[model samples]
Target: SLVKTGTGELTLSGDNTYSGGTTISDGTLIAASVNALGSGDIDNSGVLKVGEGELKNTLFGSGSLVKTGTGVLTLSGDNTYSGGTTISDGTL
Candidate 1:
């Protein structure tokens, strides 16, 4: 489930799979090419952005992949590796 409450724009292209855990609570914009094997989370009090996308064979949790306030987070793509990327907010 992908839910954006206000000021919304969302897009997902081919080979896209998200089983659970994608949320943008306030002021949301997601332009997507997401391939999920299990878990993915973007918890924002403001903004979360990933353009030019390929998040392959994914599982991300731990600190739950967070960005808070005055927020602009962008990940550009070319063989992007997170190896089951765990961002625990302890600094990955």
Candidate 2:
């Protein structure tokens, strides 16, 4: 599993294939590539920023999500995050 901590922003731009999932404990995690987040669940306790990608993972946590850029982010499955989601410039 991958745990994203601290402040600022982190961008994933490669074709990741880790199945253990991802945990965003703080700051922002940005998916710069299509399959940057891999193919697992995402437990976000911070902020998840997306530009263009398809998320088939189950997103669950107490963090917020932001969709930016000028692309489409396809989210599949039920999201149970307690925080809020804001689309400032992109399509979710």
Candidate 3:
């Protein structure tokens, strides 16, 4: 799923499977599940909030992230998303 560039927020809860990948270009995207952000790398140029659970990816294909915001963002996962994090601003 995609959160288009604007003033919107995407909230995810419970188990989900939409592996097309997520891209936040101009808003907030909240992940409440380990798989909430899917098994793909998140290309976030906005805010990402992890409220509960973890955001993880398969070992076979390591997860990745890109963060850019001043808001507090946390990844409390037993994260295998090892594609490397590039944070221009905010916390990982």
Top of the candidates by lDDT: 2
Best by TM-score: 2
Where's the lowest-lDDT run of ten residues in candidate 3? 57-66
Against the hidden reference, what TM-scores do the models get?
0.20, 0.89, 0.52
> lDDT of candidate 1?
0.38
Q: Write the per-residue lDDT of candidate 1 for residues 1-92, one digit (tens) a residue.
A: 56556766444434445556555555644443333212455444434434333333232322123322232333432322222322222221
- lDDT (Cα atoms) of all candidates against the true structure: 0.38, 0.84, 0.55
**On lDDT, who's better, 1 or 3?**
3
- Report per-prediction Cα RMSD to one decimal: 12.4, 1.3, 7.2
Name the Cα RMSD for model 1. 12.4
Whole-model lDDT, model 3: 0.55
- Candidate 2: segments with Cα more than 4 A from true spot: none
Q: Candidate 2 lDDT, tens digit per residue, 8-89? A: 8889877888879899999999887458887778899999887777777889999998887888988886878888989988
